[model samples]
Target: MTTHTPYGDDPSQYAELTLPDGAPRGVAVLVHGGFWKPEHDIEHAQPLVPSLVEAGWATWAIEYRRGTGAADTLADVRAAIAACPVEHPVRVAIGHSAGGHLAAWAATQQVGLTHVVSQAGVLDLRAAHDAGLGGGAVARFLGHPPGEADAGVDPIRQVPLAVPLWCVHGRADDVVPLAQSQAYVAAATAAGGAAELIEVAGDHFDVIDPASEAWARVLGLIEQLGRPAG
Candidate 1:
């Protein structure tokens, strides 16, 4: 069974917690992406919780206020992450699309996150704005063009993350181009950050589907990140 916990007074500031059958090896914080819109809620990520649980991991599927602005959305993500159980030895933040941007942005904060996985994330807000993704979604979220110096929220601008970053993007992703992940990973690596980009065969949604091969690869990356270094 899954339990829903409210992180804030707003109805959107809640998270669904799912536990494994046995002891959990770690906790996976799942953030859904819908170009930062209300239409895409945590329910879209529910299908992934069971798989994570079955993999011996506890899951926290977060729902945050969207379409408000980047600050509010980020605040909700931070609050939800803070609400997670800290006793878990390993913590990973997994997000798709806009959520991927949030996941990567969260890593920049001192949130005690061990790893971050961005699936088809719009890492480069500036580029995304220029590309006219989601019909000016970036400008709407940031309240201005990318040149306004909101590097704090822009994942690509905030390169060389403290935590290890795993960027998985579908080559055929029409929603968010593959170049977003590729460029971000390259910049992170160049800036002396630990990052890797995995190109998969699928679309933007395929990376989030629990049954898709892209999702299986995401699970594999999570497992790899959970392992202790020699």
Candidate 2:
């Protein structure tokens, strides 16, 4: 795992997992989420790095500013992608939990992205806050009341960036809830965005458990996106 310091004043950091071969099929940037709390960083997704690399894709394990004190993780994600070698186009953004929300947001900022894979993503920030997920780190990340989070940063309310979005959630996830992904799909589709929803069997962390069958299913989504669009 090769680490790279972001090109800004922020203390944000990131790392990369390159394929053994010379050129990569594409780049997959993994964004971790602990409801945007400072306690959880990108390292949470480290276990899943080899999953993409083994599939011929280079991976960038991202550690963006988490709390309200630092820059928005959304901005950090954009900077990290911008810093990536232009030659290796960003094939997709795979974000888990809050990172999933960020990935969905990042997909809108770029034009050539293959797609966005949201793993247990937060489609409605306000909903999470309202449901009391925002009491701790989540509240700091969103910088507002639960109602504000629902009405303000809701991914559904934002303009669709026109990239294909695949939202996956564990049918039994209690922390982020499966309904979040469903709501996001509904909003994305209503906004004319390309969206796909998959209900896998697992809990919050199990969704990223590389050993679980659910992990393989998520990678399948990435592989399908890597192929040339018809």
Candidate 3:
């Protein structure tokens, strides 16, 4: 059974936990993307939780306040990650689209995360703001244009990730250009960080859909993340 636990007072500041039937291989924190809008909540990510649970993972599908602005959205993610039990064998985060951006950002905060996976994530805030992706969604989230936004939160600007990172993007994703992941991976690698970009044949949503082949690749990456470091 799944359990809903609130990390904060806000209705959006909650996470749905899906426990495995037996000993879990690890814990996965799932973040959904809806252009950082209120209309897109955690429900869209619910379908992926069962798959993770079946794979012997305890999943925490987080819901953070979006559309309000970047600060609130980020705060909620940070709080939810902090709420994770320290006794878990491993902890990884997977985020799609805007959530991908958050997942990457969270890894840089020295949050004790084991690994991070960005599935079609918006890693470059400046580029995203310049391209006007999601109809000025970045500007709305940051409350400023890319040039004036905080550098700390911009994943591309903050290179040399603290934890292992894997980015999976669909080659056919028209909504968020594949270049977003490419540039971030390149930047992270140049900074002497451990990062990789996995390209697949699918659209934006394919990476998040549990039944899609793109999701199968995501699962493989997650499995790699759970492996012990040699």
Candidate 4:
């Protein structure tokens, strides 16, 4: 672990970078999820980062302002990626829960992020809001109802994300629910984007635990990202 690097003047606009033992196979930008709330910081990413670094990938765990306006949150992501030290190519975004939403949304923009791994991301803002998940966290993040936000604000609206997006959703996840990943993959593939869903057994937090099989599954996905699909 290296010192925190600031992408912008704001305190929230920073990232923690970790290098691998040898040459990195790629770069991974980690986004933590706390249902887009201020209380949820980037520290929760610890469980997931080591696995990535041990896998021989340089990792950047970013922190952004939560519950802030949509644009502000997204600006943080774009800047963090831009500020990352380019130790290698094959830049990828790995976001969990609320972070999953950020990762998927990042791909819709010109953020230079080529691939995405959404772990139980709140991909569908409208659906999330409708289901009232996170106790109205979606509405709080939008600063308005989800219906009022632009189509681009929702990841589901931006299908065929112009990059490969793999969603790892826990079948037993009651937080974001497996439906989020299922619907996203359905929409993404239907729109011609390279999207996949890997169903695993566990709750929302299981996906982040390094000791869990879910993390093992994620490691496999990272390996696949470095290789050209045959």
lDDT per residue, candidate 2, 106-148, as tens digits? 7766634567889999887667766776455456765545453
Worst 10 residues of 4 by lDDT: 221-230
Error of 3 at 109 (Å): 2.1
lDDT (tens digit, per residue) of candidate 4 on 28-147: 889999988989999888667887888878888999877778778988887787788764558899999999999988887776788999999999999999999999998888888788
lDDT of 4: 0.87
Evaluate model 1: give its lDDT. 0.88
Candidate 1 residues 1-230, lDDT tens each? 88989999998999988887767778899989988987778877888998888887888899999989988999999989889863576889999999999999988777778889999998999999999999999989988887857878999889899888999999999999999999999999999999999999999899988989999998998876553222
In model 4, how large is the Cα lDDT of residue 65?
A: 76
Q: How close is candidate 1 to the true structure, as a TM-score?
A: 0.96
TM-scores, all models, native as reference: 0.96, 0.88, 0.95, 0.95
Query: On a 0 to 100 scale, what is the lDDT of residue 48 in model 1?
Result: 90
RMSD of each: 2.0, 2.8, 2.0, 2.4
Give residue 34's lDDT in candidate 1 (0 to 100): 89
Query: Which scores better on lDDT, 1 or 3?
Result: 1
Highest TM-score among the candidates is held by which one? 1
How many collisions per candidate? 0, 2, 0, 0
> Model 2 off-target regions past 4 Å?
1-5, 69-71, 134-138, 146-152, 227-230
